[model samples]
Target: MSTAGPDCPQKWCTGGACDGARLDSLLTEEARWLWEQLAARADRSGEPSMTGGTAVITAPAASTQRAAVLGLLGSRPLAPGERRRIRLEELTLRLRQHGERLTPGAVAAHAAGRALGSTAAERARQIARTTGLRKLRARLAGALPKNARLRPSEEAWQELHRTGRVARVLQHPQPEQLLKTAAEVLRLLPPQGRVDRRLLAFKAAGDPHGLDAGTDLAGLVLAEAAAAGLTTSGMPPRTAWGALGVDLDRLGGGLLSLGVHPDGWLVPARFPLPLPPATLADVSWPAPPHEAPGCS
Candidate 1:
């Protein structure tokens, strides 16, 4: 991969950095496929479909700058067959090999030295800078559900098969509806709560980046349930197993629970024996924390 120089395509790139570009490309295809899978899974469960489109990546020094760009991403939702977002990074991490003016860690240290009011805010800045908007856009695009309903007229699919960048499939409108609803529900929660729930739900659905692409609509359902006061203490771990009619303790130890409240709060508990490394085989809570699809 060529470092950022005259040939690099990125706009914000400085000092001819190029290492992240290859990493960016390598991950793009897989990420796009994963988004489709997640969207499809959400659709099957009657949840919202993750939308795909171009993303704009940027990192600004102030929240106002970040907000301005985010507003743009919100406005210009990327449509299918479009490039991912424009990424922006605020950190000074060098991308390409430099003679030796600054070390990669040095930039990080410089950002760290500029102290901020809150650690969370600072951390958020760091994350945004490192991944930028491009990465997030790609992840969202890649993780969206594969729409089978939107398949081009047989002729269209054939015509574009060679030129199209994304897999052409028609998805039901229902998934999109569910995702919209979920996004609404997410807004009801505090930032922390929303973040934790999204992260957890993505994990529950087995997302690698811990970003929800609608793979586990259970999180959506759970968020709604919490908002409605259905599960105040956060959905119990057993709810997952109970749906399958399996006992936690009967399964044994290896799983734990991270419960999120509607207020953006989390309550973590060591499962089976309050210990780490607990699995389904080891869990056997008497009452079964929650209900599942087949708990009769």
Candidate 2:
């Protein structure tokens, strides 16, 4: 038997030295294409077919139909690139159902039933590491204090630097740099009124998503606001942030009314007809028995 030369396409070369690497690559591609086609067909056939508010098939019948459909897919013709999007959608659904942290390598390994090569694995690790860093930075941002003049003690900085986890996650992390950034952000916060969350982030960190919710900097700012006597009790996340002088978003600005009391009547801002003075007599409203009564 003759070996395949460097120039040979290896399509017909089935000898022992017929370029194992090229054959493996081709096989991997073909396997991926077949998987996509099968996944797409499965997705299409798995959708519920309703007739007059009733399913066309019961659980057992659906299983039988699915088996039959799978058997028939080998003979059926597929459109070019038709399965590409369906494959991705199916993969996403599977990942969500799996309920685990998703990464490119994880997805690939899940599909292939084996670990990826060193190059692909390293790429995935890099992506995961970068994502982790971003989350850590956001957390730090949220925890920042509102007082621009307030500085972390040298001992505190030394302690932070000594932490192994912090050193691993942050690239060239420095206490002075963090403090400087926090000070800049704190200076932008108004003493009495709220500012747009995105605007504050951009002004302070040059990125709108920098001080977003769950970020360390945002948390710190909120803590400072609370210490300054801002009332944020029972408020939504956006409202709470707003009370701390940061508008989380454009919406959710006004008061949120739960509902009207069962016995209460709506009062018109402008009355069409004048009412008698007796109608406006001061009547004490009954308080709930669970708690002490207090004036608003």
Candidate 3:
């Protein structure tokens, strides 16, 4: 009955699964057509990043989202000394920013133990005290010290996993690459009229292998909805958040501006854009003419 996902917990959930699964089913059908579009494009320009590379990642159930991502892509491990040096940088930052001087051994020993010490303590406190980007900066400052070591502190490791994943993300989409890719996806939009989530995929003329039709459609929806100032109060049945909350969280907010809704709808936030279309093509069923008049 819980509409909230494993990633977001129960924030917007109205205490039921609500429209999540239905939205997923609808999106899958659109993905079939999307793949065909990509194939045509691929036959021309060698298939850009949208449909290249494997977005499908496998990781243990216990792994955090970032860990699963890193585990799949693999990360360059840092030596303990290197980790310690990074920890010192974090301490230096704390001193500079907060005038809080935590000792090295205390931080290092706390590294392998429960994060009840000054660094995490300060972070938790700072996170609580601040708001918006200030809080984010505090959290980042708090996170740096944990990157000092390689092993899991749960708290420390989770933070580092995010930072590490971000570094990996930076390696791609270079500067404007992601924004451009998003633009390509957005260009599919009519620039004014609302495109049904289902029709947009087939007509969008993009089927990048890695980019699933569902997410692509969802991104456009967010862009339109943002411009329209559409809120959950006016949302139609079966929102995107229910179905793809966890997946979106892994992608984070900055790179993908999905709003609170899942990858189901709304429009534009920030850069970049995943799934193989063929895998779902077999069972896909599209509406015939007169049934869904908008799809061409």
Candidate 4:
């Protein structure tokens, strides 16, 4: 007779688990395909970053999305010694909200699988061993020297977990601003459009690696450069930031960008050009007619 739903217990559930899961799935697929395309090009040149190195990582799509969220919640370049501060800020904000279910460890594990790969995993364990929850609690204990009777809050545990979450999030596409800027670049370049690669040097906060599709962008750019006969052998590595939120105080922003090349000792004969945006490939599913076997 009675037909009522049980209370969620969460404060608000607007686009909560289902929405988050959908978005995460979409982003993970997008990120992976982009990385693959870049890897394909890099393989041709024999200098592939993600494929060759032991540190290179290839995580499941779900894992990648988690990492992105982690990066947003973790350490920022702007706040030098404010790791705890940022963690407190974000975790407190999330916990203060009712019914929130996301945790820092979940975020960290996902990101660790996606962004850092093997190298990052080691770093994460080190952080735990040296400066993780126990360390933070100890630090808190020391900081309250005069209190003589201070106990860590539940909020503190939340903050501690948030660090890994932020770190993971930062490894993804960065903030929406960078995406907007990228859209502008697409508009400016169009198909077969050539521009000074230097123009975009500072357009992104850091290197393409920090960007959501850093590997893809880097691969495409390098491929384009090689196609134009440009030499990327002597270029210096550059880094940039995503500047995620409107306020821009926290470091929920980390994106990377760089030019790719087919091989070393190559020279350029023409100005740099952007790969056609229409050529953007989706790797979520199997190859369609164009890329399928025996299809022209």
Best by TM-score: 2
Local accuracy of candidate 4 as per-residue lDDT tens digits, 1-296: 11112221231121232112222432244244323433333333333122122222233345443344344344432222222223333542342232233322222223223221334555556455434434443454344435222233434434424434324323445423332333333333323333333344335434423223334443333322222333242333221111110111122323221243223323353534232322222112223336767756
Better of 3 and 4 by TM-score: 3
- Sort all candidates by TM-score, best to worst: 2, 3, 4, 1
Give TM-scores for every candidate, taking all chains together and pairing residue i with residue i: 0.16, 0.27, 0.20, 0.16
Q: Model 4 segments beyond 4 Å from truth?
A: 1-170, 190-193, 203-296
Give the CA lDDT, 0 to 100, for residue 71 in model 1.
34
TM-score of model 1 vs. true structure? 0.16
Residue 28, model 1: lDDT of: 32
How many pairs collide in each candidate, listed in order? 61, 18, 17, 41
How many residue-pair clashes does candidate 3 contain?
Answer: 17
Weakest ten-residue segment in model 2 by summed lDDT: 48-57
lDDT of 3 by residue, 1-296 (tens): 21223222322111222222222221232223322332333223332212123222122233232232232133643222221112233322332221122222222212222211334444555445333322343343344333221111224323333434323323343413332343333444443433343333344434433234334334333332333333242353234322211122222223222233233444454523322322222333334437566756
Cα deviation at 226, candidate 4, in Å, is: 16
RMSD of 3: 31.0
Candidate 1: tens digits of C-alpha lDDT, residues 1-296: 32333323443222333223333321232233323332333323322211222223234344443333233234554344344443212111222223122222222212232211234455555445434422432333344345311111223223322432112111223434444433433332332211233334343444332323233344434432333333443447545323322223432344344542123324444322233333333434344458887877
Question: What is each predicted model's overall lDDT from 0 to 1?
Answer: 0.32, 0.42, 0.30, 0.32
1 against 3, candidate with superior lDDT: 1
